[model samples]
Target: MAAPAHTFTHDGIAFGGDYNPEQWHPSVWEEDVALMREAGVDLVAINIFGWAAVEPRSGEFTFASLDRVIELLHAAGIRVNLGTGTASPPAWLTLAHPEILPIAEDGTTRYPGGRQAWCPSSPAFRTAALSLVRAVAERFGSHPAVALWHVSNELGCHNALCYCDQSAAAFRRWLRARYNSIDALNAAWGTAFWSQTYSDWDEILPPRAALSARNPGQALDFHRFSSDELLDYYRAEAAVIRDLSDVPVTTNFMVAAHIENMDYWQWAGEMDVVANDHYLDYRLGDPRTELSFAADLSRGLALGSPWLLMEHSTGAVNWQPINFAKSPGQMLRNSLTHVARGADAVCFFQWRASLQGSEKFHSAMLPHAGTDSELWREVVELGAILSKLDEVAGSRVVADIALVFSWESWWAADAESRPSTAIGYLDQVHAVYAAFAALHMTMDVVAPGADLSEYKLVVVPGLHLVRNEEAAIINDWIADGGTALVTFFSGIVDENDRVWAGGYTGPFRDALGVAVEEFAPLAPDSRVSLDSGATGTKWSERMRVTTAEVVDAFADGPAAGSPAITRNRWGSGNAWYLSTLLEPEEYRSLALQLAAEAGVDSPVRVSGDAEGAVEVVRRRGDLASYVFAINHSNTSVQLQVSGTELITGDNNAGHNTAGHNTAGDNTVATVEVPPGAVRIIREESAS
Candidate 1:
């Protein structure tokens, strides 16, 4: 496959963050550029939120100040990812065209003080946004400093859904285009039960309250429409950029977990390169795992291409409650974690700390404490380290396993009504991914309908919504000697959130040799013991075994002594069905067992006695394999490997002790990984 255009410059990884010079004084621009060059910054994202400063009045354009900032950075040998500055429109446009403002689900008009306040489907909004995009592209298409065309800042981060009359009209048009006729729509929506049938397209409205229960099909379609509406806005801007400039155009994507509103699997096709903005959710006990989840999904969307880490927090963020700060060396570790997962670039949210704004408390490269601060010193050190490891860029992560993920399933699973309110779609995905991570195994988090011929083991976790075509694809792969793991709550609904006719598990019932008759969601704080000495919690299904071998049975519960885990031989391979949420250790063991059955193993293993968590990821280059060992626990751990330590520039020999050898002929070596530390080792032998 061909690589995306304008992803990098000078054959090195882009190492700078967002640069908003318009927020600072003119005198600060020179110093900012100098500081950037001093820190080995080669690319800077500028004008991300400069709409008010660029065009103060309607139909007016001014680029003098931004031109100076671009020129200064260009003279300093830095390339630019120039933004269209359409994220937050000027007050004049919002005040003149109030219809452009988005309406909340509660029927309140969102004001202009906040960003992303424009309704996506409003004709006035689209007209003004596309106009600004054209002007920006025409002005900077051929600028010497411009290397990338940033379409918009974090599309649909807020206000992804609008229930205004304008959006309602757009939704109706979208529904008509999809279903074609009212009869077909009524059948798909099951409107006869509630007397909500529509004879005309105009009768259909955006999903709203005042009903006992909103139509699940209507809500699902609205979610899809909202995603498409935002995508259309992006495509309109990308069209202008593509016509005016050869530079690659992209918009940074938000978290993958909350992408039920916008299906990125469809949106990624329109972009030149994939870029993502991820912030650590401090509320989670372990945020690094969430980081891996996001990065893996980002890389999957890139389809093995190198993606850009557009924006991340250097330390504390201003948005989250409590705004926890990073400990020593944690920032560097977090950035490298993304790199290990396949990010070609590592950049933060801003270059300098804001003096007066909502994000003033947010940490940046140059923090509020200035150059003498520890964060600034660590930032410089990370930059210097990244300068020497350019080989890590453009390398793809090779995994023996893949987990199926779907935005459609996520949307339908999280509807207002379901088998159980506690069954979260992404939560189950994260649980399975984390289980594999705990076993030091690497995996590709991919779409459910993605091609599965390359992987040995494919895992589908809690996919409540499954389509017939998707089921056929998986069944075909399994018949072709591929192993699969389908968990509880899967194969329950089709694309329209309608359950299959035969029973739950849909097409998978035959493949797994099991049928789910009823759901048995446990009460809060309840648990069921498994025959494998593990506990199950949250939810369980009443499953009956047919031809499959029961792997584990419930020890005690309403469905005691029943099949909790079963394996069925189908064609040349086997399919496993998990009927309950297993404990973390049991889940890891079972996942590893299935992986072993599929002839897959970890690339690296911990030897001797290690008392902490050591996560390993391997990325393959043309010449060597880069093995990244990250210690997530507070205690130090020892790892045995054969590689040249890239960070310390040490070419160690095989079977040597940590920090004690200099030869490169040994087949194994040991390294003492510090607490909360990261080590990248370049293997002596090629992968």
Candidate 2:
């Protein structure tokens, strides 16, 4: 793959993670440093929660211990990513300024039991946070070892919507900025339907249970407003840090964190580099579903910029009722998956496990047993491997397909009472994603307003909340000969979750050439067969083709004979409507068929006999392309390669049962991979 437009140099994939030396005695500091060296640790992110220690009272400051930690790491040749200790507030500040504690939506003030309990919109919290941030930056901004500045650890607030008076005032201001005038706001919110129109901004408050009815429009706006408010808080802290520090600043974001409405695209603009904390449930079929999705999201957020794997557990997390170890090769495979996706570096949640506090049981490189544990050995081995694979750092993945995933539309759709209670926003989108994954097709998950001209095919599934401008963009794309595949429950509502009144799909009715008169919710076990000899699973929408050709319909329902799939030709493009939820096989077959028609290339075609766990991603460049063939299963499987394996430092002469043989060695080889193995091959020539 071609290197990114901007080159960032790191010795190798960044190792080491949240390192807190404050809990340990000074005598153990030497041991910690030695252990880090043994494990090939190079970067140490320090002082993530030292607000109380840094400033005990209003303006009192002390940095004696912190200064020593910095000096020690610097002298040891270790890079530092300094953190502003603003995630937690001192007890005194919370006690004196009770407003600093977040107020729940139910009008209850939260007690300080956990981290991330501070109210984002609270002026008192912001003031105290800024004081400590400015102090930390001034002291360590120019430190020779510091490479980056981490602001506020994991900025997701537990109490997402603060119904406090301060938040109430902010919500009003946010609404004004969005609508510009009360008349437009009234129309957008459909306030005329329920006598809910606002005469003045002062009268508006957050859509709390006490002041509002269960209106989807009201609820949707509140979500948008709350997200904006939290973003403002993040920006406030970042502004203070940037003023005092020359180093790049960033904070860890949870990828699927929906309540925050933090447009990763917008958030990435303020950050020097994007970072995220990803945790997975092994039972969720395949970790690749969530892992690859997040990586794509992060890459898109950075506009193809590399991201940081901020946190992953070295062992099992105690928080989950049943703490399970990442079975043998699981951790290694998961970590490599991140690097393969586009992460510049990989790090875990902690270096040493804490002896006290809620996260004490969390996994670490140096476990509670001190050292010499299996977990520690694995960490060391992985770190050694990263030291060797430094060339892959800063490489980019070139993709031809883009999947449209709009957070705003997702939030708005779920906010309303839809036709099917079973039709969840994430699940519907994941269905389409699962189809693409099953076909082993590389897809770029993009936001609403991303440039679509580069992509030959775009798949938009269940786009229920079509904001005003989005329709025009889609229309233009279709008019320009772009092929778009849209599924059921699309183009039903505007930005605020209000039903588009002109027709079922207001602005898109003509483009789709279909009118959805009624929607039918399917039972959990219900099934429907399409006229194209394809079966559908769960949920179907009944609609008529106004100007398009119907290819399929429901086998049974009140509107059983109605169109289930439609195809229309607009300008130079073709628009397809999937009026019902499709079975996995059906969705995959249709997606691949459409992709073929659009002239998009499908790389890495695995034969039927090839089994066990496997994944493939292609990275293209002007001159040549690189294909990554990874075997995530326990047993080996055969694979065809046209070039060499970068990881094993081998040359591929031909397929072997034991996998590709190494250079300068004569060994019979088959693509027989052991559990959790990876291979990187560069295409001999571009297609």
Query: Model 1, residue 324: displacement in angstroms?
Result: 0.9
Candidate 1 local lDDT, residue 521: 85
Q: Which ten residues in a row have the lowest lDDT in candidate 2?
A: 1-10
lDDT of 2 by residue, 220-275 (tens): 88877776676677778777777776677778877752333555555666667878
Indicate the TM-score of model 2.
0.92
Q: What total of clashing residue pairs does each candidate reach? A: 3, 9
* Per-residue error (Å), model 1, residue 614: 1.9
* Runs in model 1 lying further than 4 Å from the true structure: 1-10, 608-612, 653-655, 658-667
TM-score, structure 1 vs. true: 0.96
User: What do the candidate models score in CA lDDT, each in turn?
Assistant: 0.84, 0.75
